[model samples]
Target: MAQKPLVLILGPAGHTGDSIVEGLLESGNYRVAGLVRPSSLTKPSTEKLRQRGVEIRAGDLKDSMADLKKHLEGVDIVVSCILAMVVLDQKDLIRAAKEVGVKRFIPCDWATPGQRGIRPMGDMKGEIRDFIVDIGLPHTFIDVGWWMQLFLPLPARSKREPEVHARVNTEYAGGTTPTALTDLRTIGRWVARIIADPRTLNHPVLICEDERTQKDAFEIGCRLSGEAESLAAKRISISAEEIESRFIKFKAASEASENPMAWEILYPYWTMAYVKSIYVMGENSIASAKKIGYLDAQALYPDMTRTTLESFAEWFYALEEPAYAHF
Candidate 1:
């Protein structure tokens, strides 16, 4: 296609939402639309999408099939970026889109596709994907890693300097499995490219930039900050016991659906391991624009890119604009 597909990104108003909108608009090829409830529309992020010519549709997954059908009209692509904790009842939008004959769909699976069969989120995506196929709808799961946006504001202990940023090392899948993190800029950029290409439809696409551990992060951070590494840093690992404990903690806190500190604390263990569910994508690969070369997108995308964890910290620091305050 000469131009990218027209897309409607549902729940494009949170941290990742703003970046995705910018990526689409900058391409000068894709027509953008954003799906938001009245609340998201009032948020500052909505204005960013609006300025990019994204039509803000005032509706949500809570809407019935008819209401969803009304909003999805003439939509070639429907991306679910909804911030739903559990998607048990959230399959309404997918069903409605299929009924409306939408060409392509991107599920709100910001996690890794390797997680599809293993993690709770993976099961959720699997259920949705299965139903979509049974009903014969074309879809793609834009499975990305833990977003790079989360690592910023860097532990509040650092030296300010122009040459370097604070270093951040993370290991989500215990210390053995690689922790693949994507820059929000890359996710937004990748989403735009996926919409532009039709070949990616009906396939699962995973994008993660680099892998690094806590030890590596500290080493890099010290170099950037112009200081020798702190000898006190300890390595942390995500074990089954840790994951189980976290699940218990979160479940207890979320009894009334009151998500608080416990939920965030426990999620890294259970959520990451479970979501790291392995599915077929040519032997668990990481893909990115920098490695594959953005122009020749037809080939199999690279599993990982050259962007390291330490360097990503620098990029986030540089984009010190108001709209994307800290991610």
Candidate 2:
């Protein structure tokens, strides 16, 4: 029998990474494998993926190229699911893939490109893209829009007054500005199809289940949570200037803190960056590239189901109660 195409998922233990694995498995067209850190061996999700017949390879980002080359031995495609801090580390992995002659490389950039005043995250992704192209590696950048999950309040933080679900907030979330908000399942489905389709190679595929403003999503959430739209909790609207100010403040605090790596400082830094990207800057950010131009790949793949905010709210609340209880 001819061997099936092998896809090695680097950083498969993450929520997005794991979703990619499930999507690929559902398709059953590619031989799936995952590259996990050595420390993640004990994770339940890691073991679950292994039991699902995924080939498991353990290696560190710090591993030498020659040492990491073994993991790419038979990998036909490499999809990286690594996060922010470890993003630049993919350079080493890319070098190893080139050394092993992998066919296609997918970097772990699920979000759209960054814009002016955004953090080094977008800049780093751009550098990665350029490096991949310069090395002559055929690649596909899957630019899925903002995750609907982030818009909803998670279980752990539900105890506090949930702001995202609020109908009125200064975050500039809900307005006429159409932002592509997507659900994880939809992201998984699109990514799997993109990986299998040869045409998607060397191009960026933009995806968004729904293009609506923050207010639209908030209204859907209010209905889902059984909240009174008229009596919805709200905050003073945040502005772009305020967001930029907070970004500088948070970044300065993060650098000045006794433990710069502390979560207290890091959380604010992340939150500020996020608010700046989605709320303050909106389409002015890097993700605006797809928002402004490019033919959405969803048109190319008509069969892929798009999830609306109402549908996402239903699915989201089904998993957990509407977190508006605190309000």
Candidate 3:
């Protein structure tokens, strides 16, 4: 009998990482391992992964190249699902992967697909990607269009009452542009298949289960949650120029402010930039992704079950309060 490939994942306890870990474990095809911070070793989420038989290693992305290489030694594949704030830090990890000659290195690109300059976060991820390509690291880039978790309207008990649901008001330039949406739970399934497939080597893949305009998604949520009136009232629209203007303003503020918490102000606008790219620039759809040389995940895996927006909304509304709020 052949030995299973060893797959090491960074950020296995995170929202997206957790899903990916679950998918890999469910597939039962590889030896799963995670590199978690030493401080988080005792956390429930980390413990859960340990209980599931995952080989947990204590290390940080900011660790020295020698240390990272040690952690990556003998790993066949490395999948990074780390947070966006620290995406640029992946350079060291990439160097380590290259040094160790891992079979595959999957970067942390679990968001909408777009070119550089369209989104700040995208640019950060792009920097790591450029470094990977420049150094000739065998890799795959995966982007799941906007999360379905953020597609629905906030559930409300009554129109006259205050909003109690955890949903936030999403401001975008347009509502008619079609944007791809993917359930967070299903991302890992797509990733699992992509990593295992030889065709995805050194290619970018877009994982989109459902595509709908913002208006259409809200209507679906309204229909499912019985909060048409309330949801409709919460729709906030902004012009493209306004989005760009605010992005500039907040970005300047974030750069100029001396306070350490300056990111708090710029974070929303950074997110707004992403929203503008998807809803107004139309960069989140499969068409856009393909235009930029991304492999269509749906076409690649026809056997995989997709969680549609309507179905996700139905399941989302039924919950008293969803524990996983990506928005």
Candidate 4:
């Protein structure tokens, strides 16, 4: 009998990392390990991962390359799901992965896919990819257009005030541009398959289960949740010019502010920029992904069940509380 390949994930307890871990475990084809910060070793989340039979190691992305290479020893694959703020820190992980001869390295790029100027975080992710290519690391870049968790409208029975739901239901840049949507939980399933396949080696893969314009998603939510009139009435529309203007205004504010906590100003800029990229720029669709040289996961894995926006809305509205509360 052959031994299972050992896969080590950098942020095993995070929203994205946890989902990826779940998918890998469910597949039952690999041995899973996690590299956690020394301080997080005792957290309940980390303990839960341990209980589930994941080998946990104490390390950080910012650790010295020697220490990271030591931690990565014996690992066949490395998948990073680190937070956006520290994405560039993956340079050390890339170097360490190369040093240890890891079979594959999956960077933390689980968001909308676009070129350098499309989104700030996308640019940072691009920087990491450039470094990976420059150093000749065996790698795969995966981008899920946007989490269905973020795309859907809030359920009518959500605990938050109706105004909050209204804010989430706003339409940006005419809301007619189509964008791919993937359930956050399903990303790992696609990733598990991608990493194990030889064809995805050193390639970019796009995981998109469904594609719809903003208005389409809103209509589905309104129809499914029986809030057609109320939700329709609350919808707000912002033009592309307005979105661009606001993005520039907030971008300048974020760059000029000297306060250490200036992320508060930058957060709004990110939101607006994302809107511009997805809607105004129309860079989040499968067509755009293919244009940018991404292998389509839907075509690659036709056997896997695809989750549609309608199905997600059915499940979401039936919940006692909203499953994802980004609004």
Q: What are the root-mean-square deviations of the candidates from the true structure over C-alphas?
A: 6.6, 3.8, 2.6, 1.6
Q: Give per-residue lDDT, candidate 1, residue 75.
A: 88
Give the clashing residue pairs of candidate 4, or none. none
**Higher-lDDT candidate of 3 and 4:** 4
Residues 1-327, candidate 4, lDDT per residue (tens digit)?
978999999899988899999999999999999999999999999999999999999998888888989999899999999988899988988998998899999999998888787577888899999999999999999989888887877765677876667667889988899999998878889888999999999999999999999899998988888888877777889999999999889878877888523678767878787888899999999999899899999999999999999998888788787645354
Candidate 4 lDDT for residue 326:
55
Q: Judged by lDDT relative to the true structure, which candidate is superior, 2 or 4?
A: 4
**Candidate number of the best lDDT:** 4
Off by over 4 Å in 2: 153-157, 160-170, 229-231, 234-236, 251-262, 284-287, 291-295, 321-327
* Candidate with more favorable, higher lDDT: 2 or 3: 3
- Expressed as tens digits, the lDDT of each residue in 1-327 for candidate 3 is 987888999999988998999889888888899999999999999899999989999999999989999999789999998987789888988888998899999999999998788687888888888999999999999999988887766766423223324234454676678889999988888888999999999999999999988778777877888878876777777778887787777767766778624568757658667866887788999999999999999999999999888889888888777434643
Q: Which candidate comes out best when scored by TM-score? A: 4
User: Any runs in candidate 4 off by more than 4 Å, and if so which?
Assistant: 161-164, 259-261, 323-327
Clashes of each: 9, 8, 0, 0
Q: Candidate 4, TM-score vs. the true structure?
A: 0.95
Better-scoring candidate (TM-score), 1 or 4: 4
Clashing pairs in 3: none
lDDT of each: 0.60, 0.73, 0.84, 0.88
Candidate 3 off by > 4 Å: 157-171, 255-261
State the displacement of the C-alpha of residue 268, model 1, in Å, after optimal TM-score superposition. Answer: 7.2
